[model samples]
Target chain A: MATILKVEGLWKNFGGLTAVSDYFLELPEGEIYGLIGPNGAGKTTVFNLISGVLKPSKGRILFQGIDITWFRPDQIAALGLTRTFQNLRLFPSLTVEMNLRIAYHTHARSGFLAALLSTPSFFREEKEIGQKVDRILELFEMSDFREEIASSLPYGWQRKLDIARALVCEPQVLLLDEPSAGMNTKEAEDLAVLIRRIHEEFRLTMMVVEHRMPFVMGLASRIQVLDYGSVIAFGTPEEIRNNQKVIEAYLGVGDLIA
Target chain B: MKQGIRAEWYFLLGGLLLFGGAFLATQFLNRYLLYILVLMGIYSIATVSLNLTNGYAGLFSLGHAAFMAIGAYTSTLLTFPLALREAYELPMLPAFLGGPNFVWPFFPAICMGGVLASVAALLIGAPVLRLRGHYLSVASLGFVVIVTTLAKTMKGLTRGPMGISAIPSYTNIYWTYLWLLITVYVIWRIVNSRFGRAMMALREDETAAQVLGVYPMKYKLMSFVVGAFFAGVAGGLYAHFTKAIRPFEFSFFLTFQIVVMLILGGMGTTAGPIVGAVSLLTLRYALKPLEEHLKIYGLIEIIYAVLLIVVMLFKPEGLVGQKRGVKKITVGGKSSA
Candidate 1:
C-alpha cells in the first residue's frame, strides 16, 4: 500500500516538559491505523503534531511525499487532511443544517461575487451542496435533527454530528481523536461499523487515537501502542492482543502480563 | 432550498416597504425630524459594519471611530470647495490631493474615503489581528488614539483644534438613504454567503475553524477591511450631512454609542443595527427638551447607559434575537408555541 502520511522522528515540547517525544509514524493510504495508549501517553499530542496544532521541536511530516512541516492547520486541511476534536466543537447557536453548510465552506467552489449575485452557476452549485448535506445527514441518521440547534441535541447525537461534520469535507485523510470516548457498548459497536463503512466509502486513510483497547483493536487493521510519549509496540490486532508490553502498559506490571 | 428562496423574497419585500415609506416621509417631514433620520442612516452603516467585525467574525475592535475620522478628514479635504480652501487659508497639499486648487465630485471623493480607510484597516489588521480577545481590542483602541492624535496635531490637513466647516452639504435625504440601502445590501450579501459562514465559524471557535480549513487570519482581515470601508463611507456621509469635521467628534463616546447600537439591536442579524440606530436616535430626540432644563451634559448618554444596563440584565442576547424569554407567543388568549 502506498503511504499517504509519513512522520519522521517528530517531537514536541512545551517549556521544560516534553508532551510528545521521538514519535514516528507511517499511515498508509486506504487503511484505518489505530494509535492506542494509556491516559497522558501523548496519543492526542501526536495527533496534534500531525494536524499542525502544535509545531514540532524536531523532525518533519510529509503528506503525499510533500514536506508539510511549516504548513498552517488550515493549509494542511486544504490539502485534504481534516480532523475532529476530542471535545465536541459544533457551532452551538447555529442549526445542524447550517453547521454542515459551514463545514463545507472550505470545499465550496463559488466566489464572493457568485454568492452576492446569486447567479445561475451559484444556484446550481448551492443546490449541489444542499443535496450533499441532505445525503450525508441521511446516512448519519441526522436528517430529523437538521433544523434543530446543534447544542440542543443529546450528547450521543452531538458526537455523531462531529464525525458527520468532518465527513462532509470529504478529506483524503481523517484524524479522529477518541471517536468512541463517551459511548456505550452498543454505540461503540455502531461507531465501529460506521467508521469502517465511512473509511471504505470515502476512500480515506485514518489515524484514530483512542484509549479504549477493544474499540481500536476491533476497528483498526493495524494498531500502534504508545506509552510515555513514544511507541512501545506496533502490530496487527492479534499481535497487539498478546504483546507483553501493551498488556503491562494497560494493566500495569502484574500477573496479567505474565 | 424552498425556505431559503422564501427568506429572500421576504427580505426584498421588507426592504421595499422600508425604503418607500422612508422616501415618502422625507418629502413631508419637518427639518429636525429629517435631520434625525439622516443621523440614523449614517449610524446604521457604521454600526452594521462594526457588527461584521465585532459580532460575526468575533474581533473586538474599538478603533472604528478612528477609521471614521480618517474618512471624515479625507472626504472633507477632497470635497471642501477650492475657493473655501483658499479663504480658510488651508495648508498646501500635494498636486494629487486637493492642493488648494482642485476638488473631486462628491461620489469619487466619498469612494476615496472608503478606499483609504480600507487601506488603513489592512495595515492595522495585518499586525493587530494576530492578537486575540482583549489584546486585539487594546491594539485597535491604540489605533483610534493614534488617528485622533494625528487629527489634533496635523494642523495643515485637519485644521488642528478649530474644526473644518463650509463642507458642501450634499448629504440630503436621497444620498443618505441610497448609501444606507447600498450598505445594507452589500453587508447582507456578505453575511449570508459562504465567506460569511467561514467568518462566523471563526467567531464561534478559531481552532475548530482552522481545523475545518477556514483560514482565521485571512477571514478576520477581510471582515476588518470590508467593515472599515463601510465605516469610512458613513463618515463621509456624516461630514457632508453636518457640514463640519472635528477631531473630537469621532471620540470614544461615538465608539461607545455605535457599540451600544449593535449590542442593543442584535449583532449577527443585519436588521438589528438599523433598529438600534433608529430607536437610539429617536430616544435622543425625545430627551432633547430636557437637556436644557437639566443643565448637565450628555444626559442622553446617561439614559443610554441605564437602558443598556437594563437590557443586558434582562436580555443578554439583545432585543431582536430573544427566542425563549416569554416561552410562548399569544395573539389574544390562544398561545402559539
Candidate 2:
C-alpha cells in the first residue's frame, strides 16, 4: 500500500526546550498506527505538527504525495486530513448536528453569496449536508442527541462526538489525540471497538496518540514508543511490548512492561 | 413543511405591523414622532450590522462608526447634486468626482458607499483581525479614532471642521424601513446557513473550527466586510436623512451607542439588536422633554447606563438571550447521560 502520510526528521522547539526532535513516521493507506509515550514525550505535539496547528522546526510532512509541511490547518483539512484535540474542543453551544455540519464546511461547495440568496444550489447543498449529518449521527448512534448542545453531552458522548466531528469532514487521514484519556476501562474498551469499526467502515489511515496501553495495543497494528521527544522503538505491538528500551522508557528497568 | 408554514405566518404578521406603522407615520403621528421612527429604523440597521461581527462572529469590533463614516462620505460625494458640487468649493474633488453636470442616483450611490466601506474593511481586517480579544478591540477602536482624525484634517474632501450641509433628504420612513427589512433578511439568511454556522464555530472555539477545516481568516474577514458594508449603508441613510454629514457625528459616541443597543437587545440573535435599537431610541426620545424640563442635560445617558448595569447583573445574555435548555431534545430524550 502507498504511504498516506510521510513525516521525516520532525523537530519542534519551544523557546529553549525541545518539544520534539528527529521524529519520523510513515503511515500506509488504511493502516492504524499508534503513538505512545510518557507525559512529556511530545505525542500531541507530533499530532499538532502533522495537522498544521504548529510549524515543525525541522521536518517534512507529505500527505498523499503532497508536501503539506507549511499548509495552514484549514488547508491541511481541506486536503483530507482532520484531527481531534486531547482536551474536548467542541463548539460548545452548537447542537450536535450543527457541529458536524461545521466540520462538513470544507466539503460543502456553497459560498457566502449563495447563503445570502438562498439559491436553489444552496438549498441543494444544505439538504445534502443535512443528509450527511443524519447518516453520521445514525452511524454513531447519536441520532437521539442530534439536537443536544455539544457542551451538554455526557463526557463519554462528547468524546465520541469529537471523533464523529472529525469523521464528518470525510478525511482520508484522522489524527486522534489522547482519545481515551478520561474514559474508564470499559468505556475505553468500547471506544477501541468503535474505532476498529470506523477503521473497517471508512478504510481510513489513522494515527492515534494514546496513553492507554490495552486500547492502543488492541486497536493499532503497529506502535511507536517515544521518550524525551525521540522514538525509542517502532515495531508491531508485540515487539514494542517486549523491547528493552521501550519497556525501560515506560516503566524503568526491571519493571513489568504492561 | 411545518417550519415553512410558521415562517410564512411570521412574514404575514411582520408585514401587517410594518404597514400599520408606516400608516401611523404618514397619517396619525406628528412630524417629530415620524422623525424619531426614522431614526429608530436607521439605528436598527446600524445595530443589526454591528451584531454580525460582535454578536455572531465574536469579533468585538469598535470601528463600525469608521466604516459608516466612509460610507457616509462616499455616498455624500457621489450624490451631492452636481449643482451643489460647484457651490461647495471642494478643492480636492478630482475631475472624475467634481466633473460638471453629473449626480449619481440614490440606490447605486448608497451601494457604492457600502462597497467602499467593505473595501476599507478588507484592507484593515486583513492585518488587524490577526489579533485576538482585547488587542483586536483596541485596534478597531484606534481605527475609529484615525478615521475621525482624517475627516477632521481632510479639508478638501470633507470641508474639515465645517463639515458639509445641504445634503438632499433622500431617506424617509419607506426607504429606512426597506433597508431595515433587507438587512434583517440578508443577515437572517446568513446566520441560518453553513457560512453562519462556520462563524459561530469560530466564535465558540477557533482552534477547533480550524481543525475542522474552517479557515479562520476567510470567515472572519467575510463577516467583518459584510458587517462594514451594511454599516456603510446605514451611514449613507443617516447622511441623507439628517440632510448633513459631519465627521464628529460618526465618532466613538455613535459607535458606543450602537454597541449599547446590541448589548441591550442581545447578541447572536437576529431580533435582539432591533429590539435594542427600538427600546433605547424610544427611551432617548421620551426623556428629551423631561431633561429639558428639569434642565438636566445628561439624564438620558444616565438612565441608559443604569439600565445596562441592571441588565448585566441579572440577564447578561441580553433580553432575547437564547435559553440554553429550550431546544426540544425529545427523541426519547431521557435526560442527558
Backbone clash numbers for all candidates listed = 0, 0
Give the per-residue lDDT of model 1 (tens digit) for A36-116: 888888888888888888889999999999898888888888888889888778787777887888878667888878877
Model 2 docking grade: acceptable
List the DockQ of the predictions in order.
Answer: 0.36, 0.42
Measured with C-alpha atoms, the lDDT of residue B31 in candidate 2 is 90
Candidate 1 structure quality by residue, lDDT tens digits, B1-337 = 3355566677688778867878887789989888988899899999989989998898989888998988888888888776677777675457767554667789888888999999999999999999999999899989988898899988888888787999899887778777787788777777777788899899887888888889988899999999999899999999999998889898887888999988899878777888888899889888988997888778989999999999888876777864422312222221111
How well is each residue in B215-307 modelled by candidate 2, as lDDT tens digits? 999989989999999999999999999989889998998998999899999999889999999999999998899999999999998998899
Model 1 residue pairs with clashes: none
Local accuracy of candidate 2 as per-residue lDDT tens digits, A61-132 = 999999999999999999999999887798888789889988898888887787776677877888788888
TM-score each candidate. 0.94, 0.94
Look at candidate 2 and give me any clashing residue pairs: none
lDDT value for model 1:
0.85
